[model samples]
Target: MPKTLEGEIAADHAEHPTAANGAGATSVRHDRRTSVPRAAWLIGPALVAGVAYLDPGNVASNMTAGAQYGYLLVWVVVLGNVMAWLIQYLSAKLGIVTGRSLPEVLGGRIRSRWGRRAYWLQAELVAMATDLAEVIGGAVALNLLFGIPLIWGGLITGTVSIGLLVLQSRRGPRTFEFVIIGLLAIIAIGFTVGVFVAPPSPAGMLDGLVPRFADANSVLLAASILGATIMPHAIYAHSALSRDRFATRRGEQAGERGATGSGGAAPSGATGKIAWHGFGIRRGTDVAPELTPGTATAVPTDTLVRATKWDVTIAMAIAGTVNLCILLLAAVNLAGVEGTDSLEGAYAALGVALGPVIATLFAVGLLASGLASTSVGAYAGAEIMYGLLHVRVPLLLRRLVTLIPALAILALGFDPTTSLVLSQVVLSFGIPFALIPLVALTAKAGVLGRWKNHWATTAAGVAASVFLITLNGVLLWLVLTGA
Candidate 1:
């Protein structure tokens, strides 16, 4: 939500040149900050959002696809990745345009007190559900690599992840972004090596990219893979992240200024509500007036948005490639191997088929995904809560809140990998809550102003949402009927 400097702001600045509240007081400050753009700033948000794509849930789901169905369901993974690109792009756009995250917009729209509370509660549940896969996934990797028990491994994961968040917090968002990007590299490297160790048949892999299911059961499995790949909490999280990362300098942290004698209340700028709404932008305005600190230059908002598109495209391409590799490796090395549908079975099979070293490398990738994605899940939880409640808490507290469900599952001694896969199916059920709202809100001119969603974008979003909903319905019916 970028705010344009209007006549009133300049006039106010002229009258109260020293007034902290005067937009004029900040005008020169902005002019000094908007000069140069960095590659890190441009691409950081998408890289952070892309972490969700490489999490443990994806590992289990993609592995299951390759192991159980071979290359038959690879198209579903591609479809889900495309859906993710769309979802993340729209989410980032909403934040960049409106200066408000999706949760903030949703909070503003939900007028009823109880209704907002209900939304918050449901979002919290979804956040916890999201955390289950990440936490369990990392723990499974721990067990695989170090012989740690599931419950203990989960505890270790929660503790280490929280520490990472706290450490990253001290280092600032730039450091955090680089850390996640580094972990993504770890994952990408693991799978790159995996491809060489157990390459899929060229003809079959190509055919797998075509949209066809081998059987009805594969349809159910495709739904599962699709659901696992496109995250619910991620949409909310990405918008907030983009809003934070790409926002103007002093955007939300410094509230709008006012003259001391004026006795007027300026909006709380916390969390980048530049214009409060991006709809109906003033005519002839080229960019947001507020400048990001560091550049003594003024850049157009359109350019900023264009930079975001580049970030999304590049980051998502890497994510999609890594995800495809997961399926390919599974299909080639472990899919038809007896019992390889299980994570443990797959690990053992990988050791037998390739070597223990390759299997361990796979576990290393899983470990990295588990650790990085859990941090992201916690971020999404905090955003959802703050979006609805407007309260911020310590990162550790948020991490602990999100970890409750994962800890409970571990305490019960459930199978870690099984629980992670089931958590993804649960994740599928929560998509509509986040996805439908994103599509609906972004389509409105009131929210996006000149940045309103394209007709084709809206159509595709709705179509995809409906398809997933229908697939979820089919899944539910089969579960109830034991089909």
Candidate 2:
């Protein structure tokens, strides 16, 4: 069965062309549903990889691990990136083929009632807990950069929810793209500047990339990196974003076209018979229509080609390089400090090793990462609500959900460094909760239609999932029993 919103939109459009069509015959709103061409799939990961780098939880994880172990933990980050790439590619393929996100596909299409409720509850908890980290981390960074009290910063960060909501409502999906790109640039520049001064040795850097098993923290930290990279939201966000680029029905056609020589239908005729699918936008509205329903009315091949794999791959590589640079910077500057357990300690040590100006820049980078990641987390939370409940939550309300924990964490007084570590732990703990369902959904041919995972892909995905689950389990056991 189609979702309530998809059904409602489809039925209403079928019933009332005039309502969907606008008062003036001069312009008409194309149906939002349509198949997308080959290029549209790139949009999601390109957008998400940027946001993932800037996420506050990720910063904390990278910063803390870097400070404590130096470049010794670089291997964990490398492995995490490789694993995340595999998972996200699998996730995007699932969406492109099946036309539904992981949660809904698992809940409504594939699972039993009990399974649906369990998955929903689990995903919701992960979303809520994840927001707390974003809010608190952003607030902490604000405190460091602006000299504002943590409590006030939390209040200010909480208020950011209103801004995010406004962006979502007025700017629509493009707002997400704009904010993520800007933050990614900010972080990239900061790392570049920082690394130029305190570069890691090539030998040490290579060593860092090798997996370490010398300590419990190393094992757990590796898990945290993987957990952070393969976030629950990335799975859903990738699917939703892909839909925005292409319609499910025409995805095969677009793929076949891209595979063959049909780069795009012979450019729109002089009569404009081949207009771009999901291309038109009137001023003042941010939400673009999905590509599938509208591809019938336009030239999707050209427009989608604009959102090519090269675009996404380049963006992911940049984000990955930037993330690696930040870890290298921390390893170089703060690795020797016995007490450098927190970002503040790392910042203070950076000021000594680099300079006050460099330290200030680090703060600026941290702040950018926090705010960017916070927006992604908040957006994921709102989208999950829309998909699960069939109604969108106001951005203002979602901000409150983020702010409450931020304010409490700041006001009640937790050690900022410790808090950062715990946030990474929380993210790690949540991974198995997200991954098991992802594996199950991908493996089932009936659920994914013709887009189901191939035997080799399923084997690889399941193997990865089980290895991660066991890794997470061992970490949990060690934490509990102090082994």
Candidate 3:
């Protein structure tokens, strides 16, 4: 029989005696409460995960959409971001409540060995597709800025990502978060500055929000935009990031105990001690009171969840705004310009129209986006392998392996922008595999316990899933029939 939440808490506490005594936990909690700046420390994991949203695939897709369709697909970007906020919140909630990533949860639930392997196979492919976009984007940026060969540029991007991953592994998650967030800041400045220099027409922008498509090609760009924005890897990465960020550690319960008073009584509520278990929170006398690792005991489930919402909101706002700015910059300036649909062309045009400074900044932003996002993508891929396959591969080896496809694409002289847009389209097709399982799992009371999704949340997830699947279907039909 499966162990109950109470049993898990007892086992966890037994493994860490310091947690029960509250000896080491109090000072750690106090430091967290007193030392770090409130807003800066609290908002992180989402920002790291949000890097995936502003990846090279996003720039390629959005820029292509703007240059080709000229504000016609603004509704797609906005709608995808709206859906992304809800989806990301649920992913974070699952991690905080269950103390497991989406991949880890699915790994345990699938039951069949073959079935798990099959799921992992598709997820791994999706992750590879994500890497293809980021590495290529970075490579293209390097080529634009320094006149390097695409292959060498890809190799350099891959090398930098491995270094970033090393930083993540050695320095711990918080340090990694800080580093990625710094890159995110650079990405924001690089991508959005051009918009101020040449803003899209307000009337045209408003029209683009009406939810209509121009043609079959427009449908492809829409799918690519959605794919780039609401990424499968981001979904996988956020849950794990949340799990790692909020996992209860030794003496964490002491912080909560400290919060209630010296006597360690439950605060205000009539319930028993607040016990955090592996699966969910248990409030009663029956369960052993314990806290998990990584999170402070003083931070309760409600507080962490609230913080997560803010984290996700801020991250999404930044990602969404940058993505929109990328499109609008192109829409206002590059639309109808010959050869402006590609990243290289776009770079040249921006230089010609807006001066070399803006173009240089644009390349710099793309480079940052590629670097930060590829690191996060590699992280997600690692988590997916660990959670679903239950196998551990060195991050360096995984980075090398994933780099092959992107490097080959670059070496073969495939158009980087086209490859990026198509990679996102592949990511679009993979969305249902991640989204359906996440929505279904989070909706179950057995999974999240009291934190299960509300009816409306479930409905929204279902609607988003259906819309994305339908969009992919239309894209497939258009391609096959040459619509």
Candidate 4:
């Protein structure tokens, strides 16, 4: 079960500042010397966006967009990535600077009675919408693979995902990371093999990257592509991941003050009563009883910074390359190559061109992506709900909130083959709704302090937001007017 944002914040406050204990003092001192790697920061966006690339819904949407538009909408993915990079960077920077995640920060800052209520309402909407997509994507994959009824699949997925939530609570971070990484590897292998067997031409690929809006259908597809890429949960995930790293850095190293205090008593400045329920803190004074001229010191801050950067950079490189490869695979092999002109058509093409086995592999990749992306979405929903309302709803309940819509879709007996594609479009429509707060938070120096966005970053972020809003609006108008 996930704790409410208030509950989490309260728990955090109850924690005794590591600075107070002797080990805390040492950690603070060590923090001063530890330097983060230059590359660590780059991982922030990849962690938020990479798995999303694998998202079943995104795969469906991108494939469909490619088939319908014949590579012309490749610009949408490129543009979405550009926007994702800017927004996620802002989220990471904000989390690092404030020592707070997006939801937590917003909870503290938005104090108006009606305004707060409205924010919570909107957040809940985003959560439900995002989760709905995940549930549908998973169900679609199951239907594709085993011929399970879509409704049955949705119910099963909801149950299994809840179990995963419980397991996550007990599992350590390293173990969880390994699981996600392994899944990513399997999906990557599947997609790469499919691409290698039936590659697209380089010339057509070049043509796909250029922007064109020749018709209403093309524009809608473009909007859907962009909307699906920069999802709402991702905005929240970016902040939370940054906070996790920040907390780890703070815990292992030292306080912000110049004092050397890693393992020690809580600092007086820090307001918390951390009970040693499951975790332990080392005393800072034990590092060296007396400062000896010959003693070896802990690593410097620059090194910690560099290490952080390195970690982020490696993650980014791996995630970005995988994403680009997946996009290429679709653009070359599946995009209007045959009479097929939709995502399902692309899969049909894969079956014909590569084989049934390859098509099955694609389905597996979609399944993996759906499950992975949804896990993050669940966490993000819990965070937002807690942040605004301070209620600790169980993970199963959150999953249910998302699962209902997918289940409904199943009852309709609709072809789930297209569910993945539609889910991305749904996400695209929801992006601007969630991103507005994120951009506002990052731009305010008061919220971020020294971590405020630079002019270039701010410009890019604002521009992305404006573009998304306008594009979504235009698409919506076209849909409503039946133009």
* TM-scores, all models, native as reference: 0.83, 0.77, 0.84, 0.78
Which one is best on lDDT? 3
lDDT of 4 by residue, 337-357 (tens): 875554456667878877898
What are the per-residue Cα lDDT tens digits for candidate 2 across 1-483? 223234434554465564333222112333344334223333544564446645666677777778778888787777666666656665555555454455545545534656555566666666766666667776777877877888787677666645654664555555556666777788778656889987788999987766666688877777766666667776666655554434333332232233232433321212211111111222321222222322321222223324434444665577667667777887887777866677777778888889988888877777776666776676556556555544445566657765676567778888865665566666666676666667677677665543456788777777777877788888888888897
Would you give me the overall lDDT of model 3? 0.82
Per-residue lDDT of 415 in model 3 = 91
Looking at model 2, report the run of 10 residues with the lowest lDDT sum.
Answer: 269-278
lDDT (C-alpha, whole model) for all candidates: 0.74, 0.60, 0.82, 0.59
lDDT (Cα, tens digit) per residue for candidate 1, span 200-295: 799998888898877656766776677677888888888877765543333322333322422244334333343221111212212223322211
* Lowest lDDT block of 10, candidate 1: 276-285
- Best-performing candidate as measured by TM-score: 3
Say what the RMSD of model 2 is. 9.9
Candidate 4 Cα errors over 4 Å, as ranges: 1-49, 245-328, 335-345, 417-419
